[model samples]
Target: MSDNVSDGVSSFADLGLGPELLNALSGLGYEEPTPIQREAIPPLLEGRDLIGQAATGTGKTAAFALPLLQGLSSDEGRTGPAALILVPTRELAVQVSQAFHRYGRGLGVRVVPIYGGQPIGWQMKALERGVDVVVATPGRALDHIGRGTLRPQEIKAVVLDEADEMLDMGFAEDIEEILRETPDDRRTVLFSATLPPRIKGLTGRYLRDPVQIQIGREEAPPGEAPLVRQNAYVVARAHKPAALGRLLDVEAPTAAIVFCRTREEVDQLTETLNGRGYRAEALHGGMSQDQRDRVMGRLRGGTAELLIATDVAARGLDVEQLTHVVNYNVPSAPESYVHRIGRVGRAGREGVAITLAEPREHRMLKTIERVTKQRITVEKVPTVADLRARRLELTRAALQESLMEDDLSRFLAVVEPLTEEFDVMEVALAAVKMAYESSGAAADEEEIPQIAPKAADREGRDRRGAGARRDRRGGTPAQGMTRLFIGLGRSAAVRPQDLVGAIAGESKLSGRDIGAIEIADRFSLVEVPESAAEQVIKALRRTTIKGRKPTIRRERDTTGRRPR
Candidate 1:
């Protein structure tokens, strides 16, 4: 282990990784391991039971992933899987599997994601083909065990990712059953953001005198806090995307972190940023660690300046010179907002923190301010005129930088001929204009709008969408109504209140627009007014209930498989 780690090692390779895994890590440009990786790797590599405490994005995934992959059997397994990793949700299952695949690429490891909502046929086939590892959600894994579709007897190791969340989602017993099924000799590794009482008890019961490792919070005392200039922009819900892009255009940050709420949002915004001509990289739980490292590498090398990522996905990211942090949407909690802003303004460097707020989220902004004791200066969305002026300023800056660095002697030769043919100043201006455009220094206005406003936005929405009533507002509904089918049901242990909470909370939908909810053992159906159905779907897509996604669609019938 490296001494800089405080716990030990300077490099990931020194921590006893296999040749192939080390080579892969090097290729990803990961020269040094984070603190969590430095301490956890050696102990886990020795096949010892361990308990790790770390925050999200702290590079904890790699801490366990390397050791878990290292412990795969030298001989073929004789059971369903050699290793079983239990995650709180399907999204995490995919994330962990991708990480393992990336780290073990050269080892020909057969790792697969096994979660519910996704079809079971694929996982069954993978299991039959001899999978080396399995990443699954507790409910789905229990379903497989009940159907006699999986056996954990040959398991060499078991990892519980986000153990706290699993307990929160009421998966403690399910986890115990899966762990008990595995052979007693199997290695155990448990990770949690906080070891609540339940997590502590589980560790006591399952892990055999585990080696405990904790990387505590990194909170700076009051007077020693960072120097981030906090500010926010208010816009309508439909116009936030445009607002974010416009702000980015005017700000013209060299490198920035855009915090999105979900993995799906990360991918979508990454595309949007790229389309705007920014070298953007996507970081999410769904990406493999190698992919993540590559994204980080690009950001570090100045190949990509914008990183679109979720809070959990960006955990443990220590980019040395980030200039700004943009909150695409306000966080659900004030603490998270603080953490997101804390990513920048580190080490006493000047930084900017910008937030894009929907009309209703202004309240959230106030709550955040009160909690952090930081005033978020409210500003109107930048106008087209503002963007144009900013672009011109950037153009002038480029010319100044050029004047200081390049030899004007060669360029003057070409300019002198033009000057002889035309007005000297006109010729020089035209040359500079051509130089700026050719370098693509126009503030990326092609994708982001020049300027936008709020009052006009409400008018536009009224012209398009139906006049839906806001139940939370004590208003009435629009003429028509809509119904959606969510493929989670009572049998899957879903609840109507959970559905209502997810929809009303994430979207602009009011309780009235969310008419009725019907839940069955295998599925559930919901009624939402037509005037707001599209918005409901969009919002529901962003929210997560019981740590599982609820697929929302037009209700086909009262009775249908909705095949959960």
Candidate 2:
């Protein structure tokens, strides 16, 4: 991949966008083009397929979208969709569809988002009405194609957004099938944060002599702050909720997303945060599409300040006001960590990424650090004294702003009377105290216990080098992990990636958290952390594996006995 810059280009107009799209960008307050946009637009506008390696929040949506919108046939007689966009999640599908509408409104362009959670009838109706573009998840798109509701014979262009994530969710087969159904001459574009072997294989097969582009995280022009501040805190599992609360108090973000590992954790944490007086909502795969939409509306409408969610449910979400991203626990994998933190630090705005790690997970944090090639400064949890000081500082700043910008003449009567009855300083102090109290400045008195890195965990990691230590048979469970039994295996076309993808996509556990796998003729065994066993089982049971719902449960102990 080539990291090339468009020299001497600054504005969207410089990149050759039509007046309609340029007017939309100007109305949306976009003054300039992001790096990816400047580089990708020209080539894509020329009908050249491209492979772009850029992180989320890099304005890649507009990069490919503008070209597709500009290339739309101006003829009103067009019947089927001309361009197709495949995203990994329903949320993203909606977001991309909205973007298309905003950019192409002057053109009267029609767009539709197809996904599983939402009713299919709505999508079918949209298709019947004739759309210029279709944004969909792979499985749902494949289903529509099979039902003869979506015709791809006339498709001119296709964009695969977040291709790596789609593959991770076990949508590889579905994606390939959908692409094969489309016209062979269709222009294809792929965007991913990271390029693994599988992604390369797909590009080799599908993207014909594509223009390659790589946009790394931009560095701060000398002496300024980086776009994103990365940091972490060490606390025991029991204190994670309290520690998170304390951090939020000190940070006082305008809007934030707290990432959790499972639906149960997300629910519990949401309740605790709301009880602590923060407007928090939970999002997970277990929630219905309507529920998910409502939660997102609350967040965007400023009615909710925090969104506690699982990785799967939170994918493809872009919130402009989000200022901080908190990890309730260390991410199970480095790629997952990268994806989580990418939600913030977008469009040149500075943001923060904070992680709360247990002592045992300290090593995992280090692994993430090495992979991202960035330092995750481990800071001590904010103390009660710190919280008080921060709150007081906030109160002082508010009063100062009011004095400078607000009309205080109406309150002169009260101030004059107080001055006559008491010292001005005393009256000021009392007013400040009232303001602090009214702002809910009282800090939690209970201090979260500070945890140090565990030496034993470090030593064990040093001994084993980088990878997880597994037994000779590759089936022995690790410490605190248990084996799970699945009735569908090799005979059912089940593979390790399928199991890992199913678990990670369904639950909060990342692929890294899933341990060894042994695929027998009619059964399969995998290891997951004991704490997450039940969640995994429930998730697997609720969903299908390779189109079959297999018996999933904790493996029975059979060491001393033979098969009956």
Candidate 3:
């Protein structure tokens, strides 16, 4: 298989796939092959052992799946699964099994996904009845092999999807055991995001004279921009919820996945977003398998527009309509960042990756930028004025789409009578007003405060100053108290009692823990124990002080000023 053959091939049909597979591809609306698919399909079809370096959402599943299906026997005499795919997570097993079913539907392919969450009895029955393909996680697959249920010797081809992830998750011994059960002559294919040394060693042991294919990261050509629009917003932790709401209003993604760090955060953020009028769902390891399935169904069915999930829970999710990936906080690692954003900008579709970073985490964002070799532009959170403009723009776009696609003949009579009685412009204005109101546009919202980016040296100095202060006090400053700035003050009829009551009522903090409170006309400053700042901010956002949600954040002072 040569590059010329891969490049010259345009469609699945041209790759020498059978009519059944090609027909299925057509029904799925797959017109052409992705870069990975284009490069990896040819060698695979020739019964060659292949090592492919590709990321998720690169169409690698189908690249190998199509060839495997094409080589399978549709006859009834085939006693067991001829193809086996090993994935790191149950979610991925299900997804890959579904793909095999879709592509081999015309040929009556019997595919089963075997994982721990599902009933073993069901899997046992399916295996007894016979299957052409089995997509499974390493642990469950090893269990079946041990129970004499799944016969690896019957498999003619094997695929290790996300091999690197499986290795990282401590599946090396399990994988080795499972492979040992399979025939030595079986055609093996492995796909990994990175070619780590462990992966190379696995290939060396299992693959013989393999065709190594490396799909480089998709980079923007010189003088051109990348496909995924990456951007970050620096926001105080207190104001992040409001800032997210504002950005969502402006971006208005058709579907999005918002990644959180913990199950509690997922639940909290989902509740907060729902209260703000978003159709949001929460997913985490705490939920049952059935619960996770229903949440996924809602997201896929378009009933939910936002999915708030922890990183572990969202692995192997593939949603075609997903337009955005929102990071509630900066990812802990550069690889994590890569995987998060890889869920979007798929199949050459435009996508956006938004990160809400606190001032202290700005350096982590830069580190991710360097490692990924991509630029993430720092953007300002949309203000109230920007939100209004965005809402109006959305309204305008809605009207334009309606004018082009909708049948408005039935309403013409009403408009005609109104135009006859008054001017046509007045009639139009009334109609536009009605449309705007029905669009769920917010009638009023206060401006979200913005923070200036700290200089490099200033940030370093701040960290050192905090450490020194901790040393001098024999503990943290103010006995580990952090001062927070509230956007409301005396001008809004706000008082120290009002602030104290609000904080106490919403957050876990009591009035005793609250330190000095200073009231100013434009803004107010209050001191709270450092550990409770996040909880207080989240609670206050859910409630209102003086009948309004004021911007709240930890106070950052470049000038030398001690807390009162």
Candidate 4:
């Protein structure tokens, strides 16, 4: 059973949720509690602290969020924060805030995300106007404390999300300082993937008689579908998008999610995928709830087969027959890699988890492998020939199934006439080929322009040891293409330096040759000589800086305007 499934699932109503929220969860398409939620919510609603060992996309936000929202509603007189959620990055902060906003829409609640890289004045104003909940990254929350624009004295509940991550990023002191600033009586919830000494130490110092929820491997399964095959492909970053496209061509999932690290990447990859002929959607923090819903609806109904999203945006998503989960970029943390892969390989069904790592990222990949204790086998992205072979296999399987189940007597007359003009075996082969190629060429294929890999790890092996060899052996020179406006923008809080550094370090270019830099709070525009655009893009797959590996392409005209 997938850990996502609640044990014998309980009704949300039975969980003792108020009517408004019960209706909201149902309307939002949530049917039951995930394991963490079932165990965590009741105590949290009663105002107890919690320490959750959960991963992203496991529905842990709602486990804490529901009770937090409920407690706030029960105390309508409190103008100050009733709950505070601490996340690791600006992307997560926004995503958590949005979840609260959606669930509390009827409560007239205010949930604001406070993070750095955005104007502090805006956050200061939001805090002053008053908020019931504040979802903030630690550094910015600490910044607010130093600036004296926020008060934690009235805070009743404080939840630490991805706690292990905050500590790993060296925020233990800051987290401690923030916790100390809050009222001593406040309910403290600490959620971490692993209870390292740091987490245990912090929990001892902070939480008082809290509930401990551990999600183990023998974890219960939920009401999840059963046909998806789960496997992970380890490839270098530069080839991720192309690798993903190749995988799509190979598996041809009716619906799948290719998880990226940012909204900008979501948009950029969505465009790349659409150009490749798949109906793709982009889901991320910048999109409104209505937009998110519509995207989900399309995916569930099969109107869109590919969904490109950041890990934050794609949370709590459940789509039927979701055949693949491609990590267009490897996650920054090991836990994130688990969560991304966990999305696919649910229930006893098979699923695929594909990670595009750069050469330098081999260490991170190894780290993820060590933590999960799961091998992510390195494999070449399927060349066109492999795709053809896989397609032919599918074609053969379909034909065999049809022969076993469907009556073919009616088609014998047609076959008899065709055999009159050609050898009977040749006629049968031709008919089969025509039927199979309807899905496009699945046999006897040629080489494709191989995307380059970021070869940082193979220091002494054959120059063709990994990403480099893949690039040298496969890719043709790309020309006549100017850098394109990739949808991954500043709204996800991306920066020019992050982009430049990523492109330079990942690709053939030294940091000096990359051109102009433009950044918006939502998006960014970078300039590179038109000739090397594709290779530069290929190189960026290996550059995993800023914890976000996004797509780089030619800029669109609408985004060319600079923010004054």
Candidate 5:
């Protein structure tokens, strides 16, 4: 067997990929293989058991996908899927399945993604008909095995993607169960970001003398820093929304994922950002599989620029053009922070990781910095003047690009006639005004107040209490009463009674405790006693109104205005 590593394999062709796969890769603009792909593809193509250690966005998907697709039998009457890839989350399952379909399109490969929250009837029918590859989450895949719809005996290869995450998510038993069902002689491949003891044990028990490959973390030379520029802004909890808006205006990332703590926070922040004129989408556990798919479609299609998500919902998501990762709040763990920032600074591209920290979370930031061994510059929030300057800068840059690249000859004809009636400078000023307005520059918003960190002892109790409350409420805690932002509004044909009836029917709170309900064009806001907010959100998420479940979250407004 050839033991050539990534250095000798410069392209997919060098890795022994077939012409059909190479053409697909070329069409997708993949000029060369990533390090993991370069190293893992050759051995995998030889049908060798392997263990790969690499983080997300390292092109790990293609490393396994290409080899698996190439190994598929071209026979038209295959009875069962030849390969099974088990992933940790439904999003990853779908993404991996799509990759297989893309790479194997010319080969007429049949791929299916099976996960919970999707109807089982279609999956059953698909499996019964025939498939070449099945990408699935462990839980859903186990369910199919029990139902006898997913025949693992015919599987020729098995892959566990993101094995560490699957173990952390408590899927160890499910993974083992599925593995036991597969044939003993099947090739096994495991990929993980970190190989803890459990993962090592898993590999020892399942893989037979696997080829080990690790793509280590990229370290900067001597004084240089990593590509992802890390920064943090200290702001009070109440001013976070406005501060995020101002900061986004200044940074203006092409696409970003804003990580929130919970489902309610995801929904509320999505609405708040949308109200601020951003195209934002919410992703959380509460959303159905179809809703999640639609949200991802909008993001990938560039119809949405901001994605507000909870950690659980954002797992295993890989967006190629993701330029920024904004932590709306400090992550609970150092590893979580690492994972969040890892989404950016990928593929040798310059990216940014921004964190908006409450004054009390300053120490947590310190912990993250120390653990990651990277300096996080704490910067001041942009002021009104700064925002105005940034907007003007954007306008000037737009005009400059247009002047350089656009064919303005026809527009110059109109400018010539105008110059006959007006001063040249005056005509230019009129054109600039139209260009600025058309670029979507709005009036500057009020500056958010900066927060000063307190001593550790004094801040600890308050921080703990706030965290507890946020956990219960699914977002920032309400002061006296809680206000919830629901994704459905007049657009969904919703009424105040609909909100009232849903809450009253689902939760313990009475209509009297529920305050004013205001339904807007696309969303609604409702207020309830602070103590009952969490219970209300949980209940309403499970119970639907108008035969649909609207995203519900604690209101994030700091303006303290009661919704009419």
Candidate 6:
């Protein structure tokens, strides 16, 4: 039994919350309930189970945490936690626990975070002292359950935060086992950024008579900037590094995350950005837990301005100062793009989502736009002129600030000597030039070739059409390249973008490097450099194309001849 409720309430008091919780919210400066909070808190306070479909920054934590706090009881006989919240990562577990502490301060709710990468004995000591709430990762929670350190019989409410992420991380069985240990009548709540089929299945099996609430991006009133300003730049593959640096110069983000497809890309891009005078840190599965913690610490402490990470490594991370999300390449899936962008534009703060797309990936940008239903404004890569002008503007701003706030008496001696030798205006100009040069002037700028919008669309059409004809007649492969036959084609709803996205996303090649693509009714043929043919074949074999692993091999000669 599930119901979808839609209504609006103006304030926390309007939602029937107690004074302690309401005061805590007010102290935290929470102005009003976000849509998810307004929709979820009432039913949750009434002790109804819920399924909340909201992104990371939409106040979902408080939506669930507030209700749990409202229902807190002081039953001395209860030996186990009154509520259990399961999160996907240790970082999120700590964050959720902190939220609970902040909201439940007046109520004296004892909350402890249990997760791996921390000594189990410390967590055991906390549990032994008794707690009202336990926030943990699924694996650690199960370990406690197995050791009898965690007693679930008294839990009145259970929360599976980021439920979809847990499933993706292979925690389904553990979640189920932990839930089975809890009382069946407990209030079960599930929150996810996405409601995939697996999540739906988990909900059906666990949550009872849940109230389903779905919240999308908030709509800013007409004539206002949207929460996230999405923009994409189409440029040639060779010039992407320069284009990205130029755009960053113009945007001047306080903190940003550049998402890459693989660990290698993350590492390489991190190095490149750092060399270009940006404070960057790389995060991927290849890093140890300690290394990851240090990187995160640096970012949170405002020491690192940029994080270059793969999708998997960046999931469930919420950074307070993140003002921009950069897609090093367009994500292969629209869902991924949504998740990546959702990290910013949080709590009414404006954020930006920028993408650097090669001309060949222009179509993927359109596909993403259509799916997310948000227009990605296609703009020219910032020119070298734009970069220089932005740098100068920054320098002027810095000088203006120093003039207004700094003690300039010490520099007066040098300026007085210069003014005596030259005109005042010329001395001033010389001083400005020195300041600007010291402030990291642009080095050896070059103009990046720009793509006309219509030209890119035409290029896509031309390549798809010509490649299909070339493959049908067994035409010679492009210079230094060979064609590989893929089993699924137009009939499988495969498009040129799909083939290109799969190859570029799964393998080391960029979309621009993947040559002509030919899609027939039953199969497809794509051209790759002769040297990369075997590598692409193995990479494709290991991954799925159009949700199926198609037969991938070199296209035969017109005479049905085999390779020597």
TM-score comparison, 3 vs 5, better candidate: 3
Per-residue lDDT of model 5, residues 112-191, tens digit only: 99998888999999999888899999999999999999999989899999898898789999999888999999999999
Evaluated against the true structure, the overall lDDT of model 1 is 0.71
What C-alpha lDDT do the candidate models reach, one value each?
0.71, 0.83, 0.80, 0.68, 0.79, 0.81
Which lDDT value does model 6 have at 435?
76
RMSD of each: 22.5, 21.6, 18.7, 18.9, 18.8, 20.8
Q: Which stretches of candidate 1 lie over 4 Å from their true place?
A: 1-8, 11-30, 46-48, 73-78, 88-95, 105-108, 116-119, 163-177, 180-186, 193-210, 216-243, 251-325, 334-353, 357-388, 397-564
Reference-based TM-score, model 2: 0.74
Report backbone clashes per prediction.
13, 0, 0, 30, 0, 0
Q: What is the lDDT for 519 in model 3?
A: 51
Ranking by TM-score: 6, 2, 3, 5, 4, 1
Model 5: CA > 4 A from native: 1-4, 18-20, 23-28, 74-78, 217-226, 373-375, 395-445, 449-564
Q: Where's the lowest-lDDT run of ten residues in candidate 4?
A: 468-477
| TM-score per model over all chains | 0.51, 0.74, 0.71, 0.55, 0.69, 0.76
Q: Write the per-residue lDDT of candidate 6 for residues 1-564, one digit (tens) a residue.
A: 234443547888889889999999999988788888888888988888899889888999999999888888434677779999999888899899999999999888899999988999999999999999999999999999989899888788889998888888899999999999999999899998888888998899998878888888775555334667787888888888888887776665657999998999899889999999989999999988899999999998867889999988887799987878999898987878888999987876667799988878988998998878886767667676766665564455445435544699998888888888899999878878887777677473788888877665555444442322222112456667787877776567675667877888788996546665655546666888789988998999999977898877776544654433
Which ten residues in a row are the worst by lDDT in model 3? 467-476
At residue 405, candidate 2 shows an lDDT of 42
lDDT of 4 by residue, 240-327 (tens): 6666777777554546788887778788889988887789999888977568778888887767878899876765465645757887
lDDT for each residue of candidate 1 in 2-109, tens digit (9 for 90 to 100): 223334468876887888888889887678887788878888887889898866556788999988777663545355577888887665787788889999898888
Which candidate has the top score in lDDT?
2
Please give, for residues 1-564, the per-residue lDDT of candidate 3 as tens digits: 235557577788778888888889999999998878888888888889999987677889998999888888444577888989999888899889988989989888889999988999999999999889999999999999989999988988889998987887789999999899999999999998777789999999999899888775565445333556787889999989989998887766667999999999999999999998999999999999999999999998878989999988897788877878999999988877877898887765556799999989999988998887776767678777776665564455445435544699999878888877999988878888887777666643857678776565345334442212211111123657787767776568675568878998888886556665555445666778889998987887888889988877666443533223
